[model samples]
Target: MQQYLFFSRDISWLGFNGRVLQEAANSSAPLFERIKFLSIYSSNLDEFYRVRFPVLMALANVPKPGEEVTDHRGILNEASQLIARQLDEFGRILQEDLLPGLKRHNIHLIYKEPVPGFLTGAVTDYFYTHVLAFLQPLWLRDYSRKFFPENNKLYLLVVLTGADGAEETAIINIPSDALPRFISLPYNGTQYILFLDDVLKLNLANIFKHYTVTGSYSFKITRDAELELQDEYEGDLAEKIENQIEKRDLGLATRFLYEPGAATRTIFNLAQTLGITSSNMVQGGSYHNLKDLSSLPIGTYKELSYQSWPSVSPKDFNTGLSIFDTIKNRDVILHIPYHSYNPVLRFFNEAAIDADTEEIYVTLYRVASDSRIANALISAARNGKKVTVFVELKARFDEANNLKWSKRMKAAGVKIIYSIPGLKVHAKVALVKKKNNNRTEYFGLLATGNFNEGTARFYTDHILFTANPNLVRELEMLFIFLGYRQHADKYPALQFNHLLVAQFNLQQTFLFLIDREMQHAQRGKPAHIIIKLNNLEEKRMITKLYDASNAGVKVQLMVRSICRLIPGVPGMSENITVTRIVDRYLEHGRIFIFHNNGDTELFMGSADWMNRNIYRRIEVCFPVLDATIKQQLMEIVQLQLNDNVQAVQLNQSGENTEVTNNLPPIASQQEIYNYVKALQA
Candidate 1:
């Protein structure tokens, strides 16, 4: 049954976490933003069972025909049956619709079988002052080796039953990483709360004062967060990524979960002492780290969350000048969470304290851990320019904070490369160089995300900035082919007529602009295309946008995450459509548009037509060439195609639906942050 052509990128990332459990079962969101979208769908299913279900259970123990293996047990039994039908539609939208719509807004969450006499004296004074001094029970017959357990935390287990009837087991631990898994009690104003696993299940008889508790449960395990780079037998690739981040907390037990009336012999003796089998345990639902409902204290209902707007910053983009004389006077874009990522960290802190700057370069795939853009490239390598950087030491989960900011930007002398071993520069480009009198001009910046001013306040990225000397000589020939010191076939003057890049010319410039909008929909003229990606998943660019939607070409799309193309599908994608917005920021810009015959050919950066961003990583994209930043990115993609409140649609069986378009509801990230705050008023 493994003939799957697509739709198993972990079941399209659990159908994009069931479109984030349809925005936490959207009952017109806002009720602690549907419990912060069910705590980001239980923190994206606990990092998809800790990093993609242990790489599909280590590719279901290999040994297959020709071994290009993709059926990791049919994508882990269709990602554990689409994560048990999205955790039974996230437990019927959190126990029959958001705990009865947060008790009709008076808010309440006290779960474990009704224990709510105004939260029993503030959960018995928070279990005698902060969870009985960090609980410590052990007894599974004197559990040794310092009682193991410490991945994805939480524990409980118990079972006792002595007095000569026979039975014993113990474990406890759940000091929810030292408290606060939702406490807030004393509420005469009617709010209440609780579940620090029912405050350690009503303080289990003050930590088993010599046994007989009966049947506690809880559970959690997760592990296998896969980070095994020996750095090609290390010579010090940042001490082999700081010794695989200290052996990534002893990685290996992938997913145990439990507490669905647990105790099948305590889930088979804790899955045979945590080596976990029977297809990695699971049972679930007594709330094992519901990704701590992303700090769900439900705070006395600030109109049930999701409101705070602030992030527009473009008073004509001039936070007191010299951002290289305002991108040398023209092309400026910026747009993230509607604008300010402080002009891409003030264009590298004003060209690292510009004294006619000199040479900078940059690439860094991700940043921010005390990064004022890595302290302005370590203050422009201590004011002696000619920098370099690259850095992407495998950026997934920011490889130990980019190997501790690449050994503090290589002890502040700066050069640093460490990336291209099978390419992953993810092009965010930088450039700089100055000293003009006797030559050397360049300036550039280009981005799409990650010069990370803390994920530019919720990721709707788009940088740009330019001095435009032919795009700073094609971004100094892509930092001389990412500093392998030239040899992108010895840079033919880094020719990128107008940049699409990735392994040179993003998939033949996006299949020659979707065959110029399928030759203007076969000469009927005025064809269209739009785009705005985050992921469309590359099936030859979704079968060339389903052959420009069977040559009628009115595409659309907007895809914010893993869309394995399947628009309307009548005659294969009825003139395509797609959607998926998920509000409160994070649409992470990519743009595209193409009605070429109608002179609408715009483009935006940091590519994502996938297939590892167009044939393996070094992405770029470009061409918005500025007619007031292409009419401000076509008015933020026509206000996210007139969002009927946090969009959705994507159908053709990959259901996300929810876009009842009548048109008066527009919530494209609060109407493109009030149309870029009314263009800075």
Candidate 2:
């Protein structure tokens, strides 16, 4: 192994964001849809700074004894450079490509003068009435005192000069949170839009009343969002978390972005007051927070947006019927966004309303505030059913909401289990028990995504509903473990023959299976493996795959994010190939296939090939017992493998190179959606 080639996962993630930017730059995409992609890219980068950048800073502070920990510094420098390059590209595309294209369609984004006379009154009146109330001006003389501006909030720096040339500067906070960013105006047979910041700039003299505005520019700051959680072992965890969330707003400043052509003195003074060092400042174009463009009301230009494709429910599944009876008959798989997620929601709703249901147990990682699943669980508790919900309160950006829902469920008589002290409960599962003719029956659901209804519309995932007794028994035992009532040794009867349960046997089982393939390869039998997951960051697992590859076992991986392994390396991973697919819907399913000397084994579930999923979280992976479902999964993987349009190969240099095979172009997401739609038709 020639020094094991690797790239920082953070930088690799930026490259993935570059793909979204590519979509925005591609003229073939619908005009408004391309704008939406650009907004998504911007928003995704914001969260990256908030969440991941702080982690890198923390890593830089950790001591590594005699070894130099320079990778963190190098990674941050590379990220800063890459972002500068991409921002330039983004600006050029918007100005040269998208703006001109919009002009051809009779749409204009007015910046400087030559305003339409008819719309001037409307724009001025709207700014005076709506935008004036939110403006709070802070003078530079009052700086170096207590002033806390919200992170990532936009502000306009206004510099004024008196008759004697005495200069003073003040900051005008743009209340984008309180008002719309873009204001549309009526033009002569054409539509025009003015950015709210420009509207303010156009009328700054009226607001100041006394000062002559020499120059004004817009700027924004990003803060390090890393929360410093106190060691909860010494005190109340909830209180500590609350304190940390409060301090997050005033965390260390990470980046200070300003409009181009900002005066040198103004930038230096603003950076000093904001506690921003030279290394943390970035100067950019006129606009900040282009992510807000997603909400721009450019009217119903049908030709400028993607055509709506309604979600199609599976042909065999009925929305108005009992889901338990449907699942009892056979296994049903749901492909979300393309296929309706209502069936999975219905599974919980029907169970809650069903008179025979005795008990309901579920593990929730992330859920929406207005969660239908949570409401159903509350209803089940109200109807005298034993309802147990293991809510993970550690879900990032959702901890407070989860805590609120946990309290609500407990108040509704549902037994609420807080997250395990050390581990996050990430499994998406529900086990329902019912009484039929004096006998107890169980039905379970396993999924690759959360029970969040809002995300289900844009994320592609899989849900398996089954009445298999063996799996149901294991699920029941797992819930007991979550409740902290039983240890691993107490669940001998819950031995898994077809399910891979994390924290007990998942890692070992996967290693055993890989070794089995390796032995078969050595014996000259046909040996192959196919795995699909969101991330592959477990070092041991990657090494095991390398071991298998060295034994002549072929590996095909479809990883969507954070792949730490370098595939296709000579003598080490020559037989391994890794591909990623980025498209309209997020690919979030996890599947594993092994060619075990002709008798293939296929499994699908919530666990990714990450360390957290294998040994830290309670996850479950069940075999595709139904032969038809197994074939369906196989076909899905095959379609992805054959995809020449959206699939990108993860090369040895960690570059996402578009596959250039001579096959006809196939975009898998569209094809899969059409495939399911045709099935319903």
Candidate 3:
């Protein structure tokens, strides 16, 4: 057996998904929130199949570039097995735990088979009114190239028998998007829930009355979602992306999923007609695409869900002082979800109105549909302020939204920057320049998350508002590089000493910091490092950390997903410990703390410790120069470290064990909210 030195990226991602399942199983979490966790897990898995599974399939027959093992088929087999087990566990959680738990609270989630007498008549009426209008049944035998199944769309492969004992198949498209997945019953006093699957099953005869539908199996196809933007820099970038979007739904089939106990003949027919081999088919339970559970009606059971934690406004910059003036002399930090995003909004809104504001620049990777940020940029352009916005068309799954915004902004006199040749601007940064009497003053905002206000309410992030002259000057230089100078490598003269810009300085800076810690540990001085990222899979960085662990430096990692580093391995990473925290709010924001022997050096950024972030994308990691702000970040990180309730220690085997000990319960997300609230008070 040729063993790889690190855990496979896909396997590690599965481990992260497993942690999500653990969230659903957690009894301390509220009931409806547990259901939401299941939804998150399903949604996460759906994306994995659409995005990562195709790569696995393509790599199955071909060998990788620098690999020791080229067993992609073997890897795919293992993935299918793991998913089967997880789905079984998922079914158990919904049926055994969630459903029964709902019933105990006077709510009944009618899981599988047999719609009640009252709901049958009421739900059937619902089906006739809402669902029946959109139902389209295509005879599978007559299926051709014109009728390829779209990705992630639900279907029922029916095995039929004619009056003369002939066999046939038809595909019924499930109108999940048009109708709600969970249909609420009209029964008074007791709450009853019904799945769309059961309603369709009961009413199957109403649509296909001519044929004897013997075996109808529910399934959904996941297509390869990798968009091939050929010759990106050569020609119309937006047009190329638009063309790819048209073909996305019809991409290569990577997974053929069907409900468990689907008849062998039905499976065979589906396999042959759909080009799904035995290797591609996965057996799931009654339900598919449980991600829809996100919309599950909580009714009056708001108590069954996690209590709302309203965003707290940062009180450092008073309303009396202008946002620009406050940031002109000091650095203000906003820990989002805990801290309100209003000040960040105020930054741009004020820029739009300020008479002295000369120019505004922003890089948007993903913004909300009705983005107030986009609206602000348009308002600035209309106000005669020169504005340039970079709308990255290469943001996966967000191409269409980006293009729409790009068109709207370009029409509004804002200069729009589309995708660069091979690089995606993954940096979350905004810059504003004010023309003072004698000189030009710059105000810059660097963030660890997107500028979208919608996500700020749930996704944990760090945003720094600064008027630091040196940092702003470097940022101005980088924007010039992006707008006109062209390629990343073409600009080595770009000096970002105060900022860590990827491709130019980020990787090297991180290496230098790790090596310094290792050197200090070798000399028997106090040395340690705490790194927090959404993922940690960059091979070189993992190698550097392994070497540091060998040098007796203490290393602690809080990686939420896709961690390849094997912690606690004797002689390999014995001194390194890796843990994960998944709670009410998403655990995002990347924070790097290096114990500089005494004077602690810290960094927060949009980039993860992944290959794409380190080597490919244009990313920015800014320093926490302000002591008070740095102290706030340190406190937040410490709270996460001390989280025993929703935190789990990950072992080398990829199992997440809860951090149980003789200590008071601490859920970091909830604690951070209170901590910031107290600070404001």
Candidate 4:
């Protein structure tokens, strides 16, 4: 076999971001969706800097960890170059494609302007009434004592000139949260969309009357988001989390973005005062914070956007019988976004009201801001049913929201479990126990995504509702372990035969499955493997996959974010191919399928192939035992494989190229919706 090493995940992640940029640049995509992609790209980059970029910065500050380590500064510098190119493409797309595309539909987004003379009156009124109240200007002469820009907030550095020719610098904060990012102007015929930046720019002198405005340049800062929780797993987690969140804005600045083509004097002066160096300074378009473009109100020209795909109820879940009764006999699997989330919600709501229900168990890593699941759990506790919830306080950006929900659940009599010091309960599972007719039964749910209803509308995930003794008993044991009923040291005795759990048997089980496929290949029988995940960076797992490829096993992967595995190399991984799909719905589910000599076994759950998932976090991967559900999942994967739209083939070169063939166009997200609808029919 040819020699190879895993690609750097940070660089591979940039390749994934490039795929998002590809959608923005694709002419086949709808105009507004293209705009939304730009927003998505910017938002993604902001997060990368907040969360991922710091690792490189830390490495840059210190020496490299190992001989095999990729150059941290080199990768970051390459990222800088990649981002520059992507931003240039973004500018061209907005200027050449989307702007003109919107104009063809009679919607105008005004960027560069000779402002219409007739609209000055409305602009003046808006400035006085809506924008002026939030404006606070700080004179920079006292810069050392009282000037700090909040993270990710847009601001303007204005060079002020007095009549005597002396000048001073002042900083003004843009209150984007208080006012709409795009304001509609009073036009008799043509629709005019103006950014709040230009509105402020046009009226800059008015806001600062004491000095003549020599120049105004826009800029924003991004700060490091990782809150180093010092003391191990001992203290008040919620308090520590809340304290960290309160200090998030004050964290060290990671990126300093300035409007490209801004005055050098203003840029240098502001950068020096803000302690920004060349490494962190990023030159952006005339406006910053364009993620707000996703919310542009174009209600009159809705036809310019892609047709919406409505969520439909699954065929197996629509029976008039109670959901509990339905799951008690046969398993029910749901494809979220394509299928209605009502059954999952009904699981909790029904449990809150069911007289036989004795307890509800849930593990929530991240939940929706206005979570119906949280409300239902609270209701269950209030209705006299015992509810034990594990709210992981260390769930990254969602820490504050989880803290709030945990407090509410705690107040309602629900038992709350905080994050373990060394681990995060990343599993998404829930169990409801019922004592009916002098028999105790368990109805359990295990999902690939969080119990967040808001995200369920746009995140592709699978949840299985089952009463199978094999799956539920193991899940019960796992829950007892989480609830302190069983000691952590006794994790080995559970003997999980049906479930593949992380930190225990998940890795070994997957390796064993690959070995089975290898044996099938050696025996000259049909053998293949299909896996999907958000990331693929586990070295040992990748090596196993390489071994499978060399053994004549056909492997296909759909890694959405970070993929370090190299595919399609002669004699190394020539039998393997990889692709990624980014569309209206995010590809969030993790699925593994092995061809067991024509009897295929399928599984789906919360774990990706990342090292953190395999060794650090609590994750679950359960089998799709029902034949019909297994077939459905197989069809879903096949459709995604056949997708000609919104799907890109990835290669060892770290490039996400569009899939082109002679077949008809099939967008997997749309096809899956139609497929589920057909099943219901």
Candidate 5:
């Protein structure tokens, strides 16, 4: 038997981003959509620098005892090279494809070129009026230590000759945070856009009148975003997390991205003065933060972007019947972005005002800024219903928003449970208890994504509404266990037969299911596995999939982000196929299906197959017990597997090879929308 191998998770993630770049480079995509793709790629890379780059740096520099030390530096170099190549393609697509396409539509984006001489006076006057107030220039040599540039904030370093004829350097902060990154200029019948950086470069002489401006280069520093809590078990987790959020921008520098063509000595001096090591210094383009391109003023040129597809209201709930009534009689599933999110909102809103509702329980990993659901929860608490909310403050980059909502809810008489010590409750489940005719009835929602309405419009996910007694009872038990704030081992009575709760029976049940499939394959009965997740990185699960493949159990996987399993490997994973899809909507669901001798078993929830989900967090994956909903979900997965457009196959080397065939094109997102609409019809 040949040995099995796995791809590096980080490198595989970069390859996923490369597929995003492919969308940007595709000529068939709408012009503005292509620009949006470029923005996504840039934003994704910035996050990699902030979050994952630090992990790679730590692994290479500080290895733990007994940990297998591999060539981490080599992996780092490979990542760097891959990003460099992607950035090159990014530049090419912008310059060669997108910019010209914009010009054809009478839009002129002033990129690297100097501001047109005809508009210099207008821009110079506008700059002094609109952009001058936010400028703060400091001499690097005098204030290097005191100047703490915030993470991912843009700055320009200027080389100038002082009045005394001595060479000097000063740093000017780009006020993109305050002012618009892309400024619009008036031109007859044509729209003109300028990067705020170029506006600063053009007007440097006005700000530094005493010094001769020799050159200016744009740069930004990306800091590590990981927050380390000193003690999780002993203190207020919410207060500790709030403190950490305050210090997040001040963490160690991870990358120093600077424009090329700066003098070598000047770069060295700047690094030394700012306490940045040479290894973190990376040569970037003339503009440091292209993520702001997302806001490019594509004024009234709606034709250049994707045509809108109005959200459809599901038929059952739109019939003027109560949402609670619809769920009580049968299980219902809504595919978001295709189906309107009103049902989910109404589920909470009704529970708030319903006379029978006695309690509401929810786990919020990431809450929307102006969440209607959170507002409804507050109302429920105010109306004398027992509302318990588990707000996971450790949801990175969202700690502040979660804290804000948690405080408001607590003030409104809601019982707010902060994150579990040393664990993140990533489950997207909610339970509502009501009294009907003196009998207790429970309604629950198990979803594949967050409860954020804003994200619901762009993330393709599934939310299951069920009144199944078994599932709802198990959900109530899980919430009770969460309220205790103890590890699963401490609460031995908490066992789930209907739902798969991580840190308890989730991993073992999944393994057992895979082994069962292997047994079926050995018996020459029908056997296969179909799983979809945002990421897959757990070694044991991947090994089990390989074992199933060797046992003749066909495996079809839809992993949207980081996938480490090397597919199509002879004698190991030859029977397994991996597909990735990136479209207008983010594929964010986790669905697992196993052919139990042709009577398939399906589950969907928030957990990925990553180690953090399996061992470090309390994730919940529930079985699809209803036959009609199960059939619909199975059909959706089949559509995704059959997708040719917006889908790519992953090879053994983790490259995203395009899926091609002679059959008619089937973009799963569009097809699913049509399928759901027809079902309503």
Candidate 6:
């Protein structure tokens, strides 16, 4: 027996975020893009506090039965230190680089300074007019029940003193949600942007007319976002989820982030009264919610941003034939964000009105707010076609949006299926059945991302349109199982030869594939494995890959975040290499390739090798049978692997090191865009 090593999932995730910060610090990136990376880092940290931090705290409190307790406290401390350093770097980039860069471009962002003398009048006027109506101030002592700091909502704690020297505190909300976080004012032939916090700071005298404002500190409390749902086989799950969404903000506070320079007594008092533990107290910069920096008014300074690459229309879908007819002839694949998403939209729009169409089945995880796909389904139902949509209401943070779409679709005659009792249907597949001249034709759409066109604009994903009956039949079977909405174990055993579905054959088939590669290596034949995913944390799958690595099968992984397997470890994973890329678009597609001696097998789907995906959810991974599409995927992945710029190699300790060599620089996103555009030409 050999002892294996794995990186802590939380720490590995932090390392991924560190890579994002690196992009922010990269002087070569566009100024606005760097600012955007800062915003992304802030947003990612907030979610980690809301979701993962609570788990860490809970784990620290639990004691093992026989063995020593888990050192969750140590892990938490390490994570905290990493976060503090990252935040320091964040401030450095914002103050030292981004702000000065904006200044060079004739834009002034009022950060920690007082309002410019010329702009004071304009700031006060805007505050009294646009910002006054939403202001609600409460005395911290008097409004105990009336005010609990809502999760992640910004507020200023004002320490006030009467004329007699007696002091008290009041909290006023910063209405960034109601208004823009950055207010732009042009003065003295220069563009000036001010944080809403500063505007409120300048106008505090108007709000508290009688008190002498001694101190003010900005702070926000991040609450746990996990929704606890009862496994009730009886009631309305949608209604239950809706209720939970309403209560999400009121969960236990996981982080109490307050601006530095607040008195120790004041910080502790605020924490005590607000139900926040001292452990949750974190001293931060003057401005919290820097994620709002995404909205910084840089105006039309095109030079401050990356040159936009307009999405190209895929040549295969532009033959002027109907989308169904085109897919009926051969399999079609779209590399999204690089390729225009109009064809995907047209796929459903045509199905809604196509007279021969009789039935449609699909699974939706995260639905766009104004989903054209959902609307098309509603229309298809109205046009007398049977439309069944399995809407996963359990998608984190998007539960409310999904539930909203579910209600509208149900009311419009589409048969909407809610989530199973203990399983989330995360498969992104759609089936369209048509009856033409007493012949039945099926068109299936499978994707490595959500069906939401909104996300497709910025998330790099792949969508496959095929008329293969083998894959379509397996997809139909999965949808039928989802319709039951029972516990996964209660469903009948399903046999899928063509599709790898979780909770059934997904994990097993993946293990079997790795085993085949190991066997090939044992026979002294060429063997290799290539995979790309958003996350890879499933232990069994990783161990199997380690087995393959030890057996001389080369493994290459492009994991965007949260990879646990330690690559380049001697005799364990020495043959495995992990590469991470962060660039203009979010890398999101899941691709897996196996070198079966001389024959290569390729797959792309919605599944990531995570515990929840493999054991607790309904996921689908499908094979790429079309030779042309397979070759294209292989070529694109090779471009990514060869990338020197915007790509990093992860070592055994999970640290991201720059991918450097004597080869010429290759930014894969740009190269892939050129590749796809050339194909169009």
lDDT of each: 0.77, 0.82, 0.87, 0.87, 0.92, 0.92
lDDT of 1 by residue, 1-681 (tens): 112234556677688778878888777777677777787878778887878788777677864558654557877887788788888888888889888888887767876575766566668777888787887777777656666677888888878777776788878787877777888764667777777788777767666666677778888787876676632443655566677777776787787778877557677986786556877777877777776876867655667776677676777565577767666777777678666677677778878898898888888888788888888988988999878888877777788888888788889899888766456778787888888688777778887777878878888877777777767787777777666532233434456777778887778988988988898789899889888888878787888788788879899998877888878777778888888888666677787888788688787888888788887678887887777878877887888888877788777777677788677888877777778888777
- All candidates: CA RMSD (Å): 24.0, 2.7, 2.1, 1.8, 1.4, 1.4
Give the residue spans of candidate 3 off by over 4 A: 1-4, 485-492, 660-662
Preferred candidate (TM-score higher): 1 or 2: 2
**Pairs of residues at least 3 apart in sequence or in different chains that clash in candidate 5:** none
lDDT of 2 by residue, 1-681 (tens): 534455577887787787778778878778888888888889888888887776676666674568433578778778878887888888787778887778888889775445567776887898888999999888888875577767899999899886677988989999898999999876787889888888888788987778899888899888877655432334555555566677777877777888867689888998888778887677877888999979977889899987787899787776455778788888888878888888878888888889999999998888798999999999989999999998886787787788778889999999987756556678888999999999999999988889899889888888889998878888888887777632223434446666688877888989999999999999999999999998888878988898999999999999887787888999889999989887777789988999998888998888987777887787888887888878877887888988888888988877788887778998888888887787777
| TM match of model 6 to true structure | 0.98
What is the model-wide C-alpha lDDT for candidate 1?
0.77
Q: In candidate 4, what are the lDDT values of residues 116-233, reduced to their tens digit? A: 8777788778888899999988878777645678889999888888878898888888889888998887487667888888788889889778779877788999999998886363
Off by over 4 Å in 6: 63-70, 486-492
The C-alpha stretches of model 2 lying farther than 4 A from their native spots are 1-3, 58-70, 111-118, 230-240, 319-321, 485-497
**Candidate 1 clash pair list:** 569-573
Question: How would you encode candidate 5's per-residue C-alpha lDDT over 358-434 as one tens digit per residue?
Answer: 99999998999999999999999999999999999999999999999999999999999888877889999999999
Give per-residue lDDT, candidate 6, residue 368: 93
Residue 89, model 5: lDDT of 97
lDDT of 3 by residue, 464-556 (tens): 999888788888887888886343336546778989999789999999999999999999998899999999998889999999998899999
